[model samples]
Target: MGQVDPHRPPWVFDCKLTARTTPNPEKFDEALRQHVGRPGHWIDLEVRGDCSDAELELIRRLAQEADTRPVVVRHVAKLISAGQEEAGHDEPS
Candidate 1:
């Protein structure tokens, strides 16, 4: 883990990956209601640091199971950095 800058806010990213498989009837079904046809599992992935290509490739392979859906990427902004003024100004708009 990187050192946490007390003055700067953190960045967060959320990703969801899904895979289809034979749903466990015992796990999916309740005694009151029977789950007949649910056949997939939705996996929730959260990244606090940077997500590299290799890490993404592994997620892609796991999500590419039969009857699976594409991976969904979501950007969640926490707060703007308060101390990195010089770095922010160097970037072109």
Candidate 2:
């Protein structure tokens, strides 16, 4: 882990997902159709900094609406750290 920068704010994280049907192959396409492609179904979302209350609510609703369970999600963010540079601590060649 890197040292946190006192002067900067914590970075926000985001994610986008495209998920298909069930674990079973026979219902895979159908599940995707019902969960992703159908009207009133949500296919993707952007999660920010652990997500906002509204966003979290939407995600929960989407999960229920799609009749799906969330396993894992990938996140992207900018990492910032403040520390002494160690480049100079080296032996002479």
Candidate 3:
């Protein structure tokens, strides 16, 4: 995990969205390519925070008529410690 800087604002997903509509009808797919993978043909589009006006407009349009398709959200993977590893203890039988 990355350390947080006190001066900068914490990462926020205020604009996070899950839309089921495809993006084939949009004209500005290139602008959101980095933010929305496969924007032109994606079945699901997840929008994070901090998007430009143009990008936001496209996202807003997508959200208006989202379909009933299932939404897919990817989560960050994390490693967990059970304390034994840190305390130099092995698994007990």
The lDDT leader among the candidates is 2
The segments of candidate 2 whose C-alpha lies over 4 angstroms from its true place after superposition are 1-46, 68-93
Q: Give Cα-based local distance difference scores for all models.
A: 0.39, 0.45, 0.43
TM-score of each: 0.26, 0.24, 0.21
Residue 41 miss distance in model 3 (angstroms): 29
Cα error, candidate 1, residue 30 (Å): 18
lDDT of 2 by residue, 1-66 (tens): 688766663653223333343666454345545545544433454343445567667555644555
Per-candidate count of clashing residue pairs (backbone under 3 Å): 0, 0, 0
Mind sharing the TM-score for model 3? 0.21
lDDT tens digits, residues 38-61, model 3? 334334544443456676555556
For candidate 2, list the clashing residue pairs, or say none.
none
lDDT of 2 at 7: 62
Give me candidate 1's TM-score against the actual structure.
Answer: 0.26
lDDT of 1 at 39: 41
TM-score of 2: 0.24
Give the higher-lDDT candidate: 1 or 2.
2
